[model samples]
Target: MRVNKLTIAALAVVAGLSLTACQNDDTAGTGRSDSSSSSKGSHSGGSAQDTAKDSAGNDSGEGQDTAAGTGSAKNGATGKCRTDELEVTAQDGTIGGDEDNTVAVTFTNGGGRDCSIAGFAGVDLKTNAGTVSAERSGEPAPATVLKDGESVSFSVSYPANDTGGSGVRVTGLVVTPPNETKSVTLDWPGAASLPVTDGSGTPVRVGPIGSAGQGS
Candidate 1:
């Protein structure tokens, strides 16, 4: 009986040793797997951060481009200047014969910078047929100044005269600023006949005008 008991005890010791070995192998394998998973997670986080930084850079670049484009339109008609902001318009019922054709020449400074109206002059009247040429017969309008984004105008008068028998009246308008000269023709299809006949039996006033829309 004692010998049998000893053999059974040895067999139980061997079984316990085998179980310990298996447990140690399982723990080592689990540790290796955990370490690999941690490394992969670290690499993924670094890649995400890099992507975020790249996206932010692209956005900043786009913003800069947009601002540059807007600035250009404000200075040049296409990208930087407000070229169309300045213009001229004539008043209604302001044109007639014998009476001062009260006209207004308007100027607008579309540039970001301010500008001034130095002075203005009226050009002589010319005919399409080239038969007649009128002299600077009347007084010119006075000098005027303008501010940035601001506008102003003055009045002009035309006398009543027979437009050289051709019956066509054409007048030239010229406005001279410190930096530029603007000209435009004021066309009257037919010169209004003067109420009184002149000494030469020709109509006294009325003619076509050429425009000098030249500006600096």
Candidate 2:
């Protein structure tokens, strides 16, 4: 009976050891699974955060660009005077054979804002025929003031010897308004010897500025 009891006790001990081994293995597997799940979740969260940051940065950059463009356009339109719509027309007027023949030029100010036409010397006039001419009357010594929707007419004097006839070929004209620079091209008859009708409807009545025989 004692041998039988000892054998049963050893068997119980072995069974308990086996159950403990199985429990330890199960615990290790559960720990590994939990660790893997935690790692995956952490990596996914990090990637999501990075994507959100990138999206936010891109949106901010676009907003800044749009704002800058708007501001630049507004300032350019309001704070500056350009050659936008400013024009000069030359008409053949009778100068009566003076050494310097006077030509009628109509100056039109076509801007949204008022600007000073100061700096007469600042304004430059060039003829396509290589004649160097200067502004004659209404020249504001240094500049003149021209308001929007206003027009001024003045005479630009040129030497009769400098130009063959009233057919003046305008090349370039620049007016330096206060805080603004304006320039335009004169492609029409700058000097004329005959009354020619302008198809452009500027009514430039071209005629002999000095000698009417010169052809343009």
Candidate 3:
């Protein structure tokens, strides 16, 4: 069969249209795509175009945050920090002169989003006997927004066994992130086993959760 010049021109136009469609699919991420954009034929057809658009949205910053598996709450979307995405730890205890010591509860963001957390983190001191939930300071605090790898901390001050008498051996600690149901567990960081007036109760004072670089 002999091909005419007109037929060649038509095929070239079709090829150009296909390439342009693919590019549009690849670039449409967030904020709603323009209705004016056009797409007719893709090299891999409609399936390819759909996949490209989906990927573009998923790869965007806000998209990654909303879809992140770490349960992180995105800033504008949820405004609550996910518990599972935080790495919680307790630093060594520093004893204040008044028979009380401060333990630092550090929270690091290990996810992809900027999240906000506030108030007193649920703290519990655990022993073989039972669990003692922490009391809130009842003071309001500004929500701390954290980016990836950013951290926030709070202080828990408890009475030290100054009398050096028989004291209960502290075994475990439980920490809950703000507005999250999940909690983080850590080992007791007491200079020695904490002493209590009685094994049944321990008076623990906790500070409000604050942003990184702020004194807890």
Candidate 4:
């Protein structure tokens, strides 16, 4: 009876040890599963954060470009003048036959901004034999910045030749702005005839554009 009792007690101890070992193994497997889940969640969060940073960086670069474009347009100090923003006219300023026969050509800035009308302006006499060329002056001067509604006048003068009915008769004149290709045709109000040679070889004389009226 004592040996039987001892054997049964030893079997109970072994069974208890096997149960505890199984429980420890299960706990270790559960811990591994939980760690894997946490690692996947961390990776997903890092990917989302990287995407957001890239988007914000692109938006910031685009905003800077837009601001630069706006600033350049607002400050037009070094901008060149356009032909569509000007108002041109011509009139006869001739006094008598002995004096210099002059024609006043005026240019006015019609826009709300300031611009420059410097350099030599090209002139053309619109005649039936196409257009006649004009000579540009060689004098150098500073450029005048014309404000809104400000005007500048330039004169085209020539020596009077009161011969017979032999001089050319030009009905109008075409004036070209400096560094511009477009031309404006204005009426001529001088006299019966202009004492300029035809388009054979001589070119009409032109002066520099001067300030007119009272706007600085």
Give the TM-score (vs. native) of candidate 2: 0.44
Ranking of candidates on lDDT, top first? 4, 3, 2, 1
> lDDT tens digits, residues 85-138, model 4?
889988877765435577778888997788887876788876554566767555
**Ranking according to TM-score, highest score first:** 4, 3, 2, 1
lDDT tens readout by residue for model 3, 174-199: 99887778888899886555666554
CA RMSD for every model?
11.8, 10.3, 20.1, 7.8
lDDT of 2 by residue, 33-97 (tens): 99999999999999999999999999999999999998887765234334564566656544565
Query: Which 10 consecutive positions of candidate 2 have the poorest summed lDDT?
Result: 207-216
Residue 176: error of model 3 in Å?
0.7
The TM-score between candidate 3 and the true structure equals 0.59
Query: Where does the lowest 10-residue lDDT sum fall in candidate 4?
Result: 207-216
Report the lDDT of model 4 for residue 201. Answer: 64
Model 4 lDDT, residue 27, Cα: 100
